[model samples]
Target: MLMNILSIGSQGGWTVAIVGYSIVFLALVCLVIVFMNLPKLLQLNLRKKLVKEGKPCAEVEDLNIEGNVNAAIAMALHMHFNQLHDEESNIITIKKVTKNYSPWSSKIYGVMNQPR
Candidate 1:
């Protein structure tokens, strides 16, 4: 910043680019962190609401699923999704149709010869 060499301007192009990239990277990281914790935050909020409404603590047990149960649920979901789509043969067929050319259907002839 103190000196410019080899026709390099003191405007700090690299510095601006680096700072801009750093800001964007930091913002995206912050967004990812928020999204990663969003489900937990939502669950906590739901728990608060459920408690306020005097719902039975049994329903709260639903929110406290273990890792194994989570894995089972994920597997079940994966299986259900896999079953939802029908299998395709993945074969493509292109059929060409042939039609005889008729003089009555010729637009070029009709355009060249005008009606009297």
Candidate 2:
């Protein structure tokens, strides 16, 4: 069926077009799936639900402090790259994350930097 569409406008160009479109379409689908699962992938949804239910009072930073050192390291990168830089909007957007587990609290200092 899709092959027919690609075959529509040109003479054998359809094969190339079809292949290109198929690759693009597949890439897009993968992207959508990743985007949809991003929240869960980051455990953001779980954190939000827990917070709303009052079952968990701990923020991510707290968890970072308590959890494995590797997780803490990962979260550190997560914080640096994921933090919002828009001072005006004041919106912190985490890519691939759906929920806000912990509100930003005291300043976070990277390993080499002095505490803020």
Candidate 3:
């Protein structure tokens, strides 16, 4: 009975495959739709929760200063720290040293007991 039901050449097998694929496709479509609207849904729920708790749901605004004002601030900061700052100095320097590769350098090899 099981062999008859699972036979690939039979109509039952094709029907089962079609039904399985359709259900998976539908589930994937539903997941895609849910994910697409998830952010807005979360925001709405958050706003509702905030209102219920008697808290403000105001959106935060970004600071948009003028370019001239930014330049002035930068100049003021540079002038204030002029004495402490270095005009021509290396921030970081890396010196490479050549070393022969050895298995003993690894932690696994180091864990082995060695005779004195």
Candidate 4:
């Protein structure tokens, strides 16, 4: 007896539907990830642009004026961590402001803003 070769099992509609939905679900997941990370991507792109424009140590104000996102972030970090004010009035202002701020308030804000 010779075996027939033309007859074969094929997938049903339900199986095809499930596979199609799964692919769509995966694509949506990827899109969500990209959307969430879009800000960081733009920031990086802006930084490269600032560098190309020969701008260094760009601050948030500068970035804003230049319409560059990366420079704003770089400037913010610089002011927060590296920049210093030498004026006596500024020192007094910081001291007086902190003196009036409650310790609990400081603790809460500090904890909330701490780097991960």
Q: What Cα-based lDDT does every candidate model obtain?
A: 0.82, 0.72, 0.77, 0.69
lDDT, residue 62, candidate 3: 30
Q: Quote the positional error of residue 12 for candidate 1 in Å.
A: 4.8
Off by over 4 Å in 3: 1-8, 53-56, 60-116
Order candidates by TM-score, high to low. 1, 3, 4, 2
Candidate order, lDDT descending: 1, 3, 2, 4
Q: Whose TM-score is higher: candidate 1's or candidate 3's?
A: 1
lDDT of 3 by residue, 1-116 (tens): 98665674866777888999999999999999999898668678877887898877774113335569989999999888995755657568889999898886867656466756
Taking all chains together, the TM-score of candidate 2 against the true structure is 0.32
Model 2: per-residue Cα lDDT over 1-116, one tens digit each: 98777668777686787899999999999999998887555677668777888876466445433348788889899898866763486678878856655534324543556655
| TM-score versus the correct structure, for each prediction | 0.43, 0.32, 0.39, 0.38
lDDT of 4 at 12: 64
Clashes of each: 0, 0, 0, 1
Task: Give the range where candidate 3 is weakest over 10 consecutive residues by summed lDDT.
Answer: 58-67
Stretches off by above 4 angstroms in model 4 are 1-11, 57-116
User: What are the per-residue Cα lDDT tens digits for candidate 4 across 1-116?
Assistant: 12232233453655777899999999999999999898667778888887888887364235444437768978899887754664355443334433575677676667558666
